[model samples]
Target chain A: MQQITTEGNQERMQRLVAVRPRLISFARLQLRDLARAEDAVQEAIEAAIEKDDTFAGRSGYETWVFGILKYKILDSLRAQRREGWWQPLDEELDEAAIDRQFQKNGRWDQEARPSDWGDPETTLHSERFWKIFDLCMTALPDTAARVFSLRELMGLSTEDICRETGLKQNNCWVILHRARLRLRACIERDWLAEEA
Target chain B: MFKMMMCKEATHLMSKRLDVPLTFQEKLSLKVHLAMCSYCTQCNQQFSLLHETGKQYEKLIERDIVTLSSGSGDSR
Candidate 1:
């Protein structure tokens, strides 16, 4: 029995290792802040160490960690909210709309391609966009921002997010909806509206 | 069923949940709303375009990752 338990712990750790990178990715997207994401992931790893035996294998190990990650993200957001690190949603939207109205003017969907058009590799692997994306992500709040990253950026489903965040379907939907709208508005104001 | 399960207030709020594409139920309500509200229709279009552009941007990011990994950014 002791040997079986030891083996199980070993398996859980291995599973945790594989999921670590993806978990960090999810947290980063959710928090829109890499340091915050890393902190959340570390918290999740600590929690997983405590409950490794409870993993029933009903879902992938990565999925389970994501569930922990979701909680970490929500906790982070709540903490930030208490610290007054949020803008009113309407204020964010109005600012985006005004920026869009001003910057877009009349030209829609006319973004220029990268300067070095022919090099697919250069475009594909450039860190330029990621750096800018990291900066703009700070504009997003904690949980709402994370939901969009998990769903939109990382390609997790509503169901997965539901499992992670411990939210019912309706609540998950609400978070996702709010996250997407805010991020879309942020991108419109910060990035897209900059062009002709 | 989705239209029935989702209310009018919820419908407008949930419209932004389409990361993949609009579902039949979502489409049904969206079509109804878009017929009356041009701004929402524009918002939806803008969302999809943003997604497409984000894909383009991801590529650029990956290249930078490679550059950093190889220490190429240090000098020629």
Candidate 2:
């Protein structure tokens, strides 16, 4: 029985190490800070190892590990919000940029109009397309990216996002709108244009 | 003179609808604008596509992690 437990622990440690990079990627996307993401993933790994004996078999090991990391990421986000680390400095600038996409008559400016992306499902399947998608996500102003991820990737409602980030409802909507515009334009320029 | 909804407002409504339900009036205006303006119509579709892509990206990462970790000899 002792030998069996020792082998199980060894296997668990190996699995944890194997999944570390993906965990870091997930954390970085959510936290947007590499060092902090690394710290959270490390802490999660340590916790998983320490609690190996008590792990309930209800969930897959990877899912269980991700659950711990998600809490860690949330803790870091709460801490950042409390510290007021992200100011809304560039929000007006973003609004101005969005306005430029339209003409004086409120029609889409010829140069800024969104083009037909013909079969976006095909693009979703392309590995290279996702690379451009990741670049576009990274290019967003930090706060916009965070709000976008919380609303879309994390599946939080607008109200919850506003509560979490201390943003007003209107402000949250504006940020999400800008994020969608920028991502659409970026993908068109980088991926769709190349295909044509 | 019938006031036509501009692409700017139409696009904002498109993005906003993804996060929250649009009021009946907002939905009617958006429907009218989209029928008249093909550009905003396309943009609206792209917004929904982007939302789906974000969801798929999340799943992709989770799938990768699961596959990597499960490569070990542990059977579950």
Q: Give the runs in model 1 whose Cα sits over 4 Å from its true position.
A: A1-5, A87-89, A93-196, B1-76
Error of 2 at A70 (Å): 2.7
Which residue window of length 10 is worst by lDDT in model 1 chain A? Answer: A107-116
User: TM-scores of the first chain across all predictions?
Assistant: 0.52, 0.80
In model 2, what is the error at residue B68, expressed in angstroms?
Answer: 3.5
For model 2, residues A72-147, the per-residue Cα lDDT tens digits are: 8878888777787655433646776677788988899898888888787786767787778778888888888888
DockQ for every model, please. Answer: 0.09, 0.58
Q: Which lDDT tens digits does candidate 1 get at residues A15-38?
A: 566556656765666666678878
lDDT at position A169, candidate 1: 59
- Across B1-76, the per-residue lDDT of candidate 1 in tens digits comes to 3333212233344445463355687667656665664445556554554344334534333333344435533332
Clashes of each: 11, 0
